[model samples]
Target: PKDQRKFGYAIVGLGNYALHQILPAFAECRYARLTALVSGDPAKARRIGAEYGIGPGHIYSYENFDSIARDPEVDAVYILLPTALHSAMTVRAFKAGKHVLCETPMATSVGDCQLMLAASKRARKYLMLGYRCHFDPLTLKAVAMLNGGAVGARQVVTTDNSDINVPLSEVAHSWRFDRSLSGGGSLINLGLYGVNGTRYLLDEDPVQVQACILPNKNPLFSSVEDTVAWTLLYKSGAVAHGSSSYTIKDASTFRVLGDKGGLLMDPATSYWANRVSLISGDATQSWGTPQFTLPALNQFSAELDYLAECVARQQPPVRASGQEGLQDMRLITAMYESAHTGQPVNT
Candidate 1:
């Protein structure tokens, strides 16, 4: 049955996330299999490919990545490069006649995102964003509840996501601390969880964005902001507030308030382990992790399997499409513009 599947993926980038999370997830995926690997480092790619049971011919370096187009084994390319490389690599993958599943934020700029979308259209290939949280069990339950009117008419949303930044000296080897590579700091890295979460939970996009950047005076953050906060005003008169910081310990949470009821989720956007509760009138209901057909800890696998199904059925992915990622990038750009001008930016 596994051999009957239609999609085979080549993972690009051997970073920590790709090495630890995405690669291992392939073992749990039903429709998606790891067929190839593309990395800047040939040794790492070959080594990892061997471990994953891929042949030497399936391993590619950055310089020869386009050769994958002729490799029948690879039907899709999953990009896990830095923010700066996302756009270029996605376009290249599409040009190589492979469907693409790129990590979130799509690209560093709105223009880059547009180029990626255009490339996908030209190549007639599917392009999906790797927003694994969209496949998380708790997030699914929350979205279903909100859509079913369990929270009544939504009014306000508040989300916060933060984690301490690695020391500058230690981060020098990676592009994460570089302005050109990372695009922005805490907001793009962590606050994006809040941005995307609010949109999904409310099922609406913000019409206006206002923001403030709290730049860390520390020399370590001279290239980017250490903390940032922003507010989103939706067309329906609903509002959402989000904040992110690299100076704080782990704290990821969100709360949704409505006219008839509300929902609160602590550790809302975590990879695992989140607590959610519903509030209505004078009663508080606790809803633990919702049951999923897939393994509780395999969100990455779920995401990959979903994309494989989309490719097999020729159906577009609803939640993690390239358009969805572009929407977030557009809003992120607006948030930065608003922060710089000290005024609200209309989306």
Candidate 2:
């Protein structure tokens, strides 16, 4: 028998990511539903809410967000706000007696991540980070293959997560271009996948970080780095190389090479259609390239159900918890520091 109860989620911030990805995902989630909508725009919220069968009473503005505390239907809040607002919104949600699922780069800094963790502890509610890749079928398969010694002991990893096309007009008005709102540009916005991805696949943290932010001549990138490249060195004698850029054509992929052979994936972190290739064999025999048939999953929906399942079981989201986000923040902070000092920073 399965738990028939579906947990209700109050979607905070009806931004593009929320509207395009998160909201659509609810339809596929078995244990989660969009019971409420929180947006600053009443008209937009009400219009969208109506489409989702959310009544006007369940639609709330940012000023009235705390009122959700009394809405028994909302068991949790999925925070899709800007990077800087994540910490505050998560804290407020917990204070309102609700579990929280916040998007990645948890907060602008390591300190804010700690604050979120503390608030979740005080509320005794679960705090889950939106590391959707963890639930992604393709990502899980790749992790399993690498860790299962399909490629042998992982020695080197390389990845690039970037979307180079952005009109200057959009950049001028987007909060992502504003440092105060987004924390950082390309790296935090798009590159975080590689930074976090390598760690997940290896099941280990980097011991040292060396990084550099590429220079941009464009005026739009004056406030933030247009591109960044980083290296993560591990104690297991493994090295990971990653890069993210707003000026490069679409490139989202990761390659893992071990002593025996290697695995490669192009378009690896996309919302759909991720493919993988593996080359492995013994020195005494010819190499074997096997084909695999993998099922595709809605990344957003899987992540939503993950938290709902945890809530139903009255347990913490240990797999993608706040601590995971905090660790990434620490690594990111170190990368920035290393970039500034022109030296390898120990993590």
Candidate 3:
């Protein structure tokens, strides 16, 4: 018999992103629904569960997370924990026979990414990365244009993503500023967007990476880099430059240059607003907001629906798989190594 029910998701971690963005997105998802929540704080879990109409029995704590395996309502686990905890939590979800959708920067290190992948494979379950941009309307248009020869062969790419940091004391317990918890600072948090964007735009991985971390005297960033810049060199002689900073005001944009034309995206990765332009010779064309088949489109909901469809059809995720995430982690690790050694590292 064909099961026509929506896939159930247990969202682990009641952090800001999960609470604000991911939780609300469940209302818009057609193929997936939030049936459970895992949090370290029982009070917070109970409050959110009440708001979402989730039963108390489906609420789980960090210590009792494994018990989710016995809950028939949870068919998948969305790992939204801190970066360092991603690997262990993902592995545990896989072992529980639940598909995983982990947030980006997958894990703190390449080794942890490998472990997560291995665990997913061992459990014979799908592991998807939560890369919302891959499902964004403007982003999808850019990808299609690049692949359709709108830009010909991409020659160079540049991106900037930055945001002002919160007070050290405020985030001290959140693990964002901890070196061990976050792996790196601006590079891992903000620059990973550029790294992944470059790869998707070029449709190829870089052959070499050169990076440098700008010195910061701020006490708040003693454990992580306050600002960082990196370059990626591709085999086709294409190059990409990316920068991320904690002290800068909010700015997110990327540009791609090719033989025939160029592409520009201002506020490229924002949740709501993004604009793209195509430049060829003296003429410039603007591609306004993209049209979607659905009545309402939320990036998070789309990604969740995509994962659910993949699970329902017994297919693997192509763009946002664990392997794709591992590739970015490897590149990030190499970039950090190159920055530390003051030398270019081969990918």
Candidate 4:
């Protein structure tokens, strides 16, 4: 009651993501607090609940996730559920009168994405995607650099080379494998980064989506994709070419090419990009580079904190929103269709 504005959150699904990132990051967030938690497993919930000092009243189960709309302690819910479950829980969270910050892909389909957007509009709340890398320090500057003509009229973008080398013991239907659970395969799971990256890198919506997909021959990701290469054509006649391989050796970095110059990003800083290089002729220049910067932030924390502020201000986030997420899914949908049918996907 002391604060005039709302500033509390309840996380649904106390799984690895919630435990590893969300709750721990809450202590650093100045505007909001982790006021509640929800989980299906009683033992784990109780353990995590005790760890966070949340008592019975502040704790919830899957059966009662919707009831929290009535709980005064929670103004919003951070849904970290599997991709298939995001839409249902987000819809429920909306109906229960809570703002929802959902982890991405947003949903498996454009229809569900639009449904969530509609719910947010109807409930008069914000729906932000967990597109954490967009809020990265170096990424923020890189976006500006592209827009400011550091790389004049960006021609292409590349967001790729994720090393997805999981053991069979680590593999589980875990939602990542089931097309029903995860929407699609690696194309949707990992390729959204490239779709969204093109827009972010050049500040443009893709006019066309041309792509090809290959299976994970190693049995590690057969149900999903092992490799994807895409070309995003912009309205400005510029093209963004990207490739994503889940079996590389930590080869994740984005490069921007323009008429004037090109920029190469350090692979280490996708979430909190610190090292960036600008190349025009031969010599290179560095900007806003971090030299032994203090413990870097969890991008999700920065993302959630920004969202908490947006919720308070009745505004949208600076990065990916429900619409943006929907667009990415649309592109992904087109990619899968094209890959199966052996055609160029036009979005």
Each candidate's TM vs. the true structure? Answer: 0.94, 0.95, 0.94, 0.91
CA shift of 302, model 4, Å: 1.8
Candidate 1 collision pairs:
none
Candidate 2 Cα outliers beyond 4 Å, as residue runs: 1-3, 164-168, 281-290
Scanning candidate 1 in windows of ten residues, the lowest lDDT window is 286-295
Model 2: per-residue lDDT, tens digit, 1-347? 35766899999999888999999999999889899999999999989998999999898888889999999999999999989999999999999999999998799999999999999999999999998888878778889888889888999999998874447668788888899998988888877889888988788999999999998899989988888999999999999999998888788989888887888877678787787777765555332333564788999998999999998888899877899999989998899899889999999
**Residues 1-347 of candidate 1: C-alpha lDDT, one tens digit per residue:** 74585579999999988998999999888888899999889888878977999888899988999989999989999999998999999989998999999998688899999999999999999999999998898888888989999779999999999984466457656577788999988898888889999999999999999999985778778887878989999999999998998877787888898988878888787776766777775544444432233336688998888989998889978869999988999999999999999999999
Scored by Cα lDDT, where does model 3 land?
Answer: 0.88
Check candidate 2 and list the clashing pairs: none
Model 4 residue 85 lDDT?
92
Per-candidate RMSD vs. true structure? 2.4, 2.3, 2.7, 2.9
TM-score of 3: 0.94
Report the lDDT tens digits of candidate 3 across residue range 106-159: 999989999999998999999999999998888888888899998788999999
Per-residue lDDT over 1-347 for candidate 4, one digit per residue giving the tens place of the 0 to 100 score: 44654478898998777888788888777677888898998888888889988888888999977789789888889999889899989999999998889998899888999899999989988888888877776677777777889978787776675654454457663667766787766567766776777777888888777778765567756667767887778788888876776555566667787887788775633544346677774445544343333345668778778888897777876566888888888888887887788777677
- Model 3 residue 122 lDDT score: 96
How good is model 2 by TM-score?
0.95
